[model samples]
Target: MAGVYDPSVQQLRSLLTLAEELHFGRAAARLYLTQPALSLQISTLERRLGVRLFTRTSRRVEVTPVGRALLPLVRNIVGATDELRDAALSSLAEGGGLRLRVGLTDCATALGATRRVIAGLTTRHPALEIDFRVVDLVEQVTGLATGRIDAAFVYLPVAEDFHIQPLTTEARVACLSSTDPLSQRASVCLADLADRPMVSLTPQVPRAVRDFWSVDPRPDGVPVRYTAHEVSRVESLLSAVSFDGARAFLPAVAAELYPRPDVRYLPVTDLPPCTFAIAWPEADGDAPHLALLADVCRALRDEGLPTDPPAPSPRTDPDASVASLAERQ
Candidate 1:
């Protein structure tokens, strides 16, 4: 009440990004601003607050005591601003358009199925704007629960509270080292993988989901062997399979989608097929739009339509332009 403090929303966002990244270049890249511009924003904000927020050195950036104390408050302000903007946009409908946030789980190999549904929705509702995010195993349902994503194409074993419809099921394949003896065979069973320990998934993943992916407590009732280290992403899992004498279960499509010279995907003969499902919050079960989305998903799969290709991967260059990314995707 004693101080006059007003900082632009972009400045506050820059503060949050810099705090999270702790590096000028990366934070600037994320903000789509030059380093000097970001530094100016931070400095101006600090001037108004009458406190230094960060201690900067050539090699590193450290948050000051005040910065740490202010982070939660800054987060709240930013979150509220975002919520208000979203509400206003919803009311306006941006030219009578509907914006949906769709999530693609890292474990969703049936991406083709999800895309077909998107296409169907687009054909029917030309004004629908689809904003989809690719989330990892850790953030699978977190995105949905937090409202970051309106719906999700996720692997099975999602919480029972959500309305889920199985879209497509594909046989699981064992991702193993190309040099492993079992890789020589056309296919292998769970028993054949006894010596090959499973890669432990991230601790944050739900127990039931992990069990579903790992096929825990083998069909023969044998204890499944898992590696001591845990992996949270596909790249890490691929590295583990390549060098750590570990194996992971992925949908058979991985053989083509993720091709690595040192890794081989052998069909797992004994394990049951893994399924992908389209899930949404239970509250939306009666919503006409969501019902239509689910129907499109089911029809695409049941009708055996040609699979939809995934958007191409964008360039890794930090300076890549938005137009370039759009073209690639």
Candidate 2:
């Protein structure tokens, strides 16, 4: 077999550095370039490679197998290049450069541990530059797919083929008005909401929403008059719910994020918990950025609040699964 050298050595160098640093902003700083410039360089490398090297979610980053395999080779090449730099530095007595860029969802409060991970990258790689982009879930996915984004913190229900890195776990809680008669109770059970109207963040499944509110083995199918996607729209949602005397199912963490004077949060006892994972494309290649994001996500996970929301009742069947709810729907 013949040895092949990439003509895009500078591009390759940047990619390898990104893989090592596992973050864009830090890598960019090291390169002495703006974050966008650094991102363009990595994007260019991916374009030439003809294969995707990374996967990202709003919460974290990941490297494909291709990225992993390429990392060591990249390190070796960069090291060799560093030796060349050392020779030049010895002669001229000059410094070098480093940088990195990071992408994330605008919802910073929701990202928990991922924030610390970025800080670590900057501290450990002082020479590196860090750049961050606030993006949405879909945009984050597209970024990883097309190489525009190195890594991100994203929600679940992503492509299965991608390598998923779990950052933390969060269970759902029902957000209700404090003024509601039910809110007077310390906690509320799923069955308690049987006939009550509700608000929801467009459910992954209509059945899932129905199941959450159903007390009977079969759902009575109460109407969800309000649906929303934006977290900021909770005020409007709350207004809608209040008008209808409805309650909404939300992640416990999310519930606390918006503390309405008129509303309170209660866990849906005996419900299955939702786990948020940071996913990346699965392939063998060197991807430094993705790995870096994953580390950050894990750190965020460490700071995560308890996944266990207060149970509706100890006597309630813990065995009750979402599948059971799915069955009725």
Candidate 3:
């Protein structure tokens, strides 16, 4: 490249750091280069850029007015360049058609948006291959932490260690078999079904869900009684083949995931709405696919679904509902 505006990133960084530190020795220490080496690099940069970037004396080192003006621009440029390099590395990891593995714990309220994010990422960044996995909340957390998965569809509140981005809120509902008498009602309340045999998430319910159910307080401080989790359980415990009168609390997404002829989903008028987020390891920090997926998720959340989701019933008490009741078990 001919010299009109040709700039070496290394030289620009050295200049920027020297300006920032205002001390040759300190700047060299920060850059892990010797002071003389840094000085030489800075001199070379000034020569190449055809400008005096700094004025130096034994007493002090100072950026010139031109250098000061250029400092902010240089910082932004260098920072952006670093980000670009990281992103390029990330793309290379994704480019070989490796699966951009995506995982979901219990379904969240924003399934529609989640689907759109996947579609958009795949279409916009065709080099990435995406595979979606459905596991429980604990497994999702462990997978992200261990780098076994790139991103997880998580319902808040996730454990503190993982980074999360909110997607959407969903109303909590009670799912039942169409054959059940409660299915005849347009809506159901927790108090109304208090005595009914509930298909409780047998495993420890995720903290967020427990809070939604108000596990600490009951009308009579009565311990909530429900059926335990059973393997091979459909989203709703009730199915044509497994048609047991078990009612489970779920978000709109879960209901949609396992739509069944024999089962009916009814709004729970007594619970608050649940929120969901996309989660990945804090360790993954800013993995590009994760970052891009988060961006795509945000876009999908803002623009909304390509097709309208079912009308959310007004009977639900959004304040108390949880998003992924499947995690409750």
What lDDT does each candidate get?
0.71, 0.53, 0.64
Compose the digit string of candidate 3's lDDT tens values, residues 21-110: 899987765554689999999998888778999998989998899898888888888778867765664576466554568886555423
On a 0 to 1 TM-score scale, where does candidate 3 land against the true structure? 0.56
Structural similarity to truth (TM-score) of each candidate: 0.60, 0.48, 0.56
Ranking of predictions according to TM-score: 1, 3, 2
Q: Model 2, which residues run further than 4 Å from truth? A: 1-111, 136-148, 197-239, 242-244, 283-285, 294-329
Q: lDDT winner between 2 and 3, please give it.
A: 3
Which candidate leads the pack in TM-score?
1
Off by over 4 Å in 1: 1-96, 106-110, 286-292, 295-329
Candidate of highest lDDT: 1
Tens digit of lDDT per residue, candidate 2, span 239-272? 6565557777654555445655666666566545
**RMSD versus native structure for model 1:** 19.9
**Better lDDT candidate (1, 3):** 1
Rank by lDDT (best first): 1, 3, 2
